[model samples]
Target: MTALGPAASLRDAYGAALVELGERDPGLVVLDADLSGSTRTQLFGQRFPDRFFNVGVMEPTMMSIAAGLSLGGRTVFASTFAVFAAGQAYNFVRQSVCYNRANVKIVATHGGLLVGGDGGTHQMVEDIGLMRGLPGMTVVVPSDAATTRAATFALAERNGPAYVRLTRESLPTVTDGSFRIGRAAELRSGNDLTVVAVGALVARGLELADDLARLGISVRVLDAASVKPFDEAAILKAARETGAILVLEEHSVLTGVGALVAAVTAEGHPVPVRRIGVPDLFGESGDPWALLDRFGMSMQRIRDEAWDLLRLRGRVE
Candidate 1:
């Protein structure tokens, strides 16, 4: 197996993407709500101070300003923590951005249960679902740093409200970063079963594919970075060809990509789908990766679950 390269943070890539976009589009503007340093938007703020707006701690005000700027034909990117971006600024996003279909990119960092010791309030487990629920909202959650940059450009190239969920810490570079909105990246090819995942879980899926292959169990791993406007065709094809699938993510199991995949499969092709994610509970304060391991998202548990699913199909003894 080829080893993944050095670890990198998504927020840094996101900030860089904004700077790149600003260079090309002179009208590209960015806004931060007192968390520029945490979200890494400070990089863009430093580069384009005239176009960057620092709106103190008011996430709602930042969002409103973003929408208003977009109305004037400016490409706007609003930065903040996931909790404040999707939770505290919900009304502003829903009314100003999504309702009007403004050209705004809500690129938020510190998403999922990966904000380390910031506790449940900062670890946003429900942000994806909240963003996905909005009308005309394009939600993209890249798996790694490179893909985060790709997602940033994709959202910027388009016109409308969108949300890009990013984690606090760094992730190993696993993918080639071939990302596009409304499409999924097929990382590994297999015929027996499929694993649809996003964020760090996508790396886990790739690892599981290799381990399962040694046991004669071919596992197809898909990086489902695009949560909204999902690739239903891909999920349906996996369901028909593989016969079973496992949906894993760092978001809530209730209304996340798991629910999206299950709904699509049920509608197109009936298949057994197992979803693994944060349960109907809140996140707590701990090391990001340690919290995930303690919550049973380890490689062993993932392998056991895959084997169990294969066993149900009489493929594993």
Candidate 2:
């Protein structure tokens, strides 16, 4: 069974959002590092050529130029593959954008292990950890295309440096709730355990929650899209009420949002918290979902972890 009627692309939604945001706001300008085709920023460029700039594979220039445009009172959006945006152009993104307090939005595409068959060279899983560590930087990872659209508009309105990570593969829309930066949504409620998932994993997390329900596990699911100002209160509440928390993400487990969840719970209200994500290994070439299963992000792994955690707490017989 699938999570919804159809799978949609978040990159497409981001490109479409750019067009809409540009129409209403003349101050909106977009920059791309010769990857507009893949990142979908070309759609906005076609609509507003005067407001768009393509830096032709110069990732650092794209970020620095976006910072310059923002300094002129323009709301700038820079797009590229996650590896280039976060890895190649990281120096400029840090010194020119974040440090200078530039209103630049780095809406990176092809993040995490979703870029199937691209291998680790193109796949980027550490963008979240990198962006969230920057001071005054707001990091958002939408679960689906619908939320991507909402997040783009919200980040446009928000000041300071921001990052939005998008996967290459299409994903099912997991929620109909409104999007708010730094807020988390509770999709399924339960007392046995809480499953906090971000990005494409949210859909899978919701799917596993249903199957766990049939086995009387009563799993709760939280869509933790915002990574920086994460909903600590919500996670803390879940930790307190549920007694255990499980975090899922497409990125590596180290320094990812799961650590923040564990930190919040450990400091505010300690609970048995376990995480399911990519190990420290690099991403390999394979089918995205299949690689996810191989990397221990499968539902079977969720069941095993849930059972183990619950058993440790004497909740499961």
Candidate 3:
């Protein structure tokens, strides 16, 4: 855990990290589907012009080219909006990347409802579920700019197909720049309950834990950055120690990290679990924070859910 800092953009951090990784590894290549500016892959293109490719607006073609590059022993990273990467280029990713287990990193930005005014057409709320279902695909959703920076480097070293989810909005820095795939970081420790959160919701989870602390409710907050190959050991430990769990995410409740957490607990140690996320519906155009609140992912909603879980567990009178 690290001290909270001012808000920073994960996309910017990701772009800078790609430049750093390119400088370190000559085999690393980048591809963008006409969204380099918005997805921040332009930074890497500027630094490594020869190693970067702009594949026009064809996301599926970009994915296929990345897969071919990976098969040629080059570490390929492709960037696009989540909607385009996961929705438009899904078949290419499945047949070329995941099926072949190519070393391609699909770093999609503007995930979830945080695309702000992009409306339902551009916002990708189902990306996590889509990517996680792919076999041999590593799913990572870093909580902040620092963690995103670390995850960018980690994915470069990892030899497999991976999907790194990033947000369009700025988020508070939470982790201390150390991130590993398939590992969860415990931001705060307590015994009453455990709140598992990811991406932008991590900062909100920390706020809820702090607020609950004043009311004598101790909450252990776990940042579940890696959605697939989830940290089951940490989750089971929390279940045994706290006996209650609440999962928070900026994506849909169905097939999100919350559902994975529930599956983990059910197999090992059954406990009361409450999940707070967007219900089964599309997101509309609005302020990013307003959209989050409207979708019931606000800090206030998380706090209320915490209280409800506590009551159900007989921890609150």
lDDT of each: 0.88, 0.89, 0.92
Which structure is stronger by lDDT: 1 or 3? 3
**TM-score for each of the candidates:** 0.98, 0.97, 0.98
Which is superior by TM-score, 1 or 2?
A: 1
Q: Rank the candidates by lDDT, best first.
A: 3, 2, 1
Model 3 residue 149 distance off true place after TM-score fit, in angstroms = 0.6
Candidate 1 ranges beyond 4 A from true positions: none
- TM-score computed on alpha carbons, candidate 2: 0.97
lDDT for each residue of candidate 1 in 7-93, tens digit (9 for 90 to 100): 898888988888899899999989998889988889988998998889999998788889989997888999999999999999999
RMSD (Cα, Å) for all candidates, in order, is: 1.0, 1.4, 1.2
Q: Where's the lowest-lDDT run of ten residues in candidate 1?
A: 1-10
**Residue-level lDDT tens digits of model 2 in 114-229:** 89898988889888888898888899999999899999999999988999999999998887738898889888888888899999999877887888788887888999998888
Model 2 spans > 4 angstroms off: 1-5
Q: State model 3's lDDT.
A: 0.92
Q: What is the lDDT of residue 161 in candidate 1?
A: 91
